[model samples]
Target: MQTSVTFKNIDPSDHLKSYVQDKLNRFDRFLDNPAEASVVLSVEKFRHIAEVNITGDRLKINGREETNDMYSAIDMVMDKLEKQIKKNKEKIRERRGSRGAVKASPMVGFADTLAEEDAEGEIVVTTIDYKPMDAEEAVMQLDLIDDSFLVFTNAKTDEVNVVYRRNDGHYGLIQPIR
Candidate 1:
């Protein structure tokens, strides 16, 4: 990753520049292609702000943090950037994996191998922010995504819920029993 740091309303410090470079270097592994990062550090009265913008491959990520100190703001913004990088990488990997995978046909002898693999299935755990939303709004959100199902926290009941598109062209909702 190539990084450039800009200081606003404060004297440029070599220490701060080096710190940002070191932090940006860690994200290079998450990116398959080379990336460019632009960082801005500014101070307004008592508020210190750090902002970073990164562009690589076909994606862009931005993170901003405000704190009483510049270093803390930089650290917080870096944490946010790391999360964004990991999420982007995971999405790319998922797209590639889903497209390349081929299922064995039942007519072929390989069906037995596939059955054994299914018996010892690989479990994947994905963490999503279950933001509270009403059922109608969640249904609308599901329409915007390519996925058939969505998991969300219900605003009215304050419980985890799922909304899925049924095979019959209707939608179904799932809620846990009280």
Candidate 2:
């Protein structure tokens, strides 16, 4: 992976640049070929902040750390990035399942089959429950579970919604419309 290190409110140093590059290289295993990583180092009062941004195939991962020591901050940021990558991988796996097969079936036939199966199996054949909640509650649940996103039923619309944590330390919500 190619890396670019930028120093803000601080002079560029060879040691710091090399350290950032080395730490980011660890992500090479997670991506096919990372396009380029942008690392920003800045000093805020007594704290040194390190931010790493990586872009890959439809995936963008970012990590930031603030500490008194620049090297420690870099290390912490890299660790966070690794964790994010792992979480994303797990989510993708869960959605796709082990058998990565997509067979197109007519919606009408599929819905008919689903209704028949439900009637046959009074027992909950599949068990996934969604609670009615708002975006803030979904975010809290995500944080408590250490998951990237939480799926819940919207309290107002009674629709399924998803809330995820973004790289910029903000939340993103997705709602589907019929």
The number of residue pairs in model 1 that clash at the backbone is 0
Candidate 1 lDDT, tens digit per residue, 100-143? 43321223111123223333467444455556788887776665
lDDT tens readout by residue for model 2, 1-178: 8998999999999999887777777777777655689999999899999998888856898888999999999988888988998888778755554343432122211112223344554753333446777677666656545557666788989998888889997989999979
Worst 10 residues of 1 by lDDT: 103-112
lDDT for 65 in candidate 1 is: 99
Best-fitting candidate, scored by TM-score = 1
> Model 2: number of clashes?
0
Candidate 2: residue 14 lDDT (0-100): 96
- Worst 10-residue lDDT window for candidate 2 reads 103-112
TM-score of each: 0.57, 0.54
Quantify all predictions' global Cα lDDT against the true fold: 0.81, 0.76
